[model samples]
Structures are given as C-alpha cells and as structure tokens.
Target: MLRFVSFTLAIVAMCNGQIAVERDPVCGTRNGFYGIEGNCDAYVECRDYRSREMQCPDGLHFDPAVAWPNYPCGYPMEVDCAGRGIAQPAQPSAECPHLYGFFPSPKATADECGYYRMCVDGVAVEMACPPGLAFNPSNARCDWPDTVSTCNAAAFLGFTCPPPPVNEIGELIEGPVNYKYEGNCFAFFSCEEGRARLLSCDAGYGFDPISGRCVDGDIIKC
Candidate 1:
C-alpha cells in the first residue's frame, strides 16, 4: 500500500532564487508521494525504492493530502499552500497571466462584462458569458454582475432589481420575480436574492412576462 509523507534531506542550496532540494532514500522503505520543504509546486515521488523529483504544472500546486492513484496536482485556488511557496516561474502571454487560468478579456469595454479568456498550457481561448452576466475572477466563473465587484451591474444589465414587497412591520418580503427585457423578446430577467440575473429562451421561444415562462415564438409577437 502507498502512503503520503514529507521527507527532507540535509543537503540544501539556494541558486538564483531557486531552491535546490535533495531527497533522502525514502522509497527504500515504502512508496509514496513526499512534499518538498518550502516548495508547494514541487514534490518527490518514491517508487520501487527509487526517488524522482516532480514539479506541478504552472498555475497548480502539489497536494500530498490526496491519496495514491489520483493526481496530486491541483489548481491553486483549491489547494492550500499554507507556508509553502511556489517555486516555478509563471509563463505569461498577452491574454494569459499564467499557463492555466481564466482571465478577463483585454479588449472588453468598461460596460462589456461578458467576455473572458480561458488559458490552458500557455494558450488562450476566448469565451463569453451568458447574457446579463459577467466574468468573476474571485471564483473564476460567470456570475451575476451585481455580485462581481469588478463589473458595474447597473450599467451592464441596464436594469435593477426592484425593492421587494414590504410586510406589516415594514420588513422586506423576499421572493423570486421575473421581468421582460424591453427590446428583446427572447431574453428576460430573473430576480433572486435582490439581484437581477439575465436569462434567455431557446431560439424558437420567447419569454412571456405575464405567464412568467418561455412560450413558442409564434404565440408571442416580439
């Protein structure tokens, strides 16, 4: 059976800001993944009494907590580096800050929050969020613009969620609400948690505000 461990060697050196690490004969006793000291992106794999140094891909970190048979490298956002630092330098491009990550498009206008780029292995691929949404860097996913601090939700959405109904004590009563986008018959807004989210219907359908559902385009003239 394989196990995870942190093995350190007495020999160490620092050359040009890179940590030169040497490992002890850990595999001589057992096979497992071993973490290097002070380096979150590097590890030592011991197998059949042989040891090999490995580095996680750019934008990823080695996670020894993961069990064997599963890749130990994971995205930086999901892995906790604790006190360990990343040793590998980043390879960036005009569109990619790192070899792998989601980034906002450089050409996007101040009011345009829908465009983004997905970087993989130093290559960038353009992507677009659904209408009425924006790219959120915090979570690296498309989310309501109102919740994205970098985006101006009111300016991009062109509408705001109305104040919820009030109760007898003047407290707000929260409930889901839907509204039509004035000029676009196929698109509409769904309000939840005081945020207005833009949604769309299928190509052959239109949003019906009265019924609060999508209907055949033939039944509702734009």
Candidate 2:
C-alpha cells in the first residue's frame, strides 16, 4: 500500500510540472498571431522565444492570455477609437488612455476614485492620485493612507514609494526591484533603497515576480 501511495504521489508531481511548463504562456508562442494578415497596429511586446513585438488594431489591448490564432491582441475593449483615433506617436505604451476617446466613467458614483480612467482630450488615461496617496477601490475613490486599515487591499492601487529602512545602516541595497510575497501571490513588493512597498496585481491574480506572471498564491508553493 505504501509503495502504491508513493507511486501516486510521483505521478501527481509529474503532472503538475508538465502542466506548469505547457501552461506557461510565451509572448510569441501563438501561431494565429503570425497568421494575422496585412498591416495592423503593433502593440505590446513579448520579449521571449517568439523574439518579436505583438500587434493588434488601434483600440484593442494586448492580452497575453489570448495569444495566437485569435485576435492579434486577444480581446478588445469598448473604447470609441473609431470615433477619435489618436495618432500613434513614435512610441506607445499598452496602458494608453489616449487610444480611445476619453470620457468620464459614465457609471462612476459621486465619490469616485482619484485616478479613474477618463477622457483627456479624447483619450482615456488614469490620472494620478495625490502625491503621498494612492487609489482605493473599496470606496471606489482615493483615500488617506490610514483609510485601508485591514487586508482588504486587493481592490486598490497601492502607493509603492516607501521610506528607507532605518534598521540597517545606510548601505545601498540594490532595488527599485519587485518581489512576490508569500502572503498574497497576486500582490508584490516594489523594493527600493531598503524599503519594500506593496502593489496590487491586476484583478483576479497574484504576482510572481520571479516569472513576472500574475498567479494565485493559494496554489503556488511560494
């Protein structure tokens, strides 16, 4: 019986490793993307084995999860890019507010988050929160540092700037680096100058800084 149990465990381990490798999405792994014919708006880059930048039409966001054989950039957001196309500058960032005609979130409550995606000159960009502050999603608005008094941090854009650590003498610690946390895999710490600050991952994910992938902490070995 013990021998059988050990064999089962080994099989499970092998399956886990296989799934991890096969599920690991690569930037250019999708053949459907390459097959996308004609000229298109090249967007985010997948700097891996595919060895090239990815592209989609002007309004679509590059969702790596939806790679190859689908839309070049996966899915598309409902932005009025067709109505107001912002001329692409020489360089572009994926989180482009200007990609679509920016308008106030029609569904926003009176007490809205500070940096909600809004139309700036017909572009949708998330405006910055106050200097010493960050956006809090619980209230769907910006709040004081003390406003978030519990672990309900998943719904906010946390401020990453932290004061230097006083415990250690002023020895330069290499940083401005991001690290995954055992507590919450989706959230990560952006550490710089000895201070590590938390930044929330995208909705429905914990971050794995080692792989630079958003993952669920509940499953990762940490």
lDDT of 1 by residue, 1-222 (tens): 122222222122232444544445665334678889889999888765568899888877899787654798987667878788655888786668889877788755557887898888879999999777798878778888988888888788888888776789998766777789999899988887778888899999999989878999999987
Q: On residues 1-222, what C-alpha lDDT tens digit does candidate 2 reach at each position? A: 999998888899888874223322534452433322223344444333343555554444344345544454422342223333332342333444344433234333333333445443345555655532345445434454335343223333343444543437776555466666555656666666544455576766667766656677564554
lDDT of 1: 0.79
Model 1: residues with Cα > 4 Å off, grouped in runs: 1-31, 166-172, 181-188, 199-208, 211-222
Candidate 2's C-alpha runs over 4 A off are 1-100, 106-155, 158-160, 166-169, 177-183, 191-222
Worst 10 residues of 2 by lDDT: 78-87
TM for candidate 1 is 0.66
Give Cα distance to truth, residue 60, candidate 1, Å: 1.7
Report RMSD (Å) for each prediction in the order shown: 11.8, 20.1
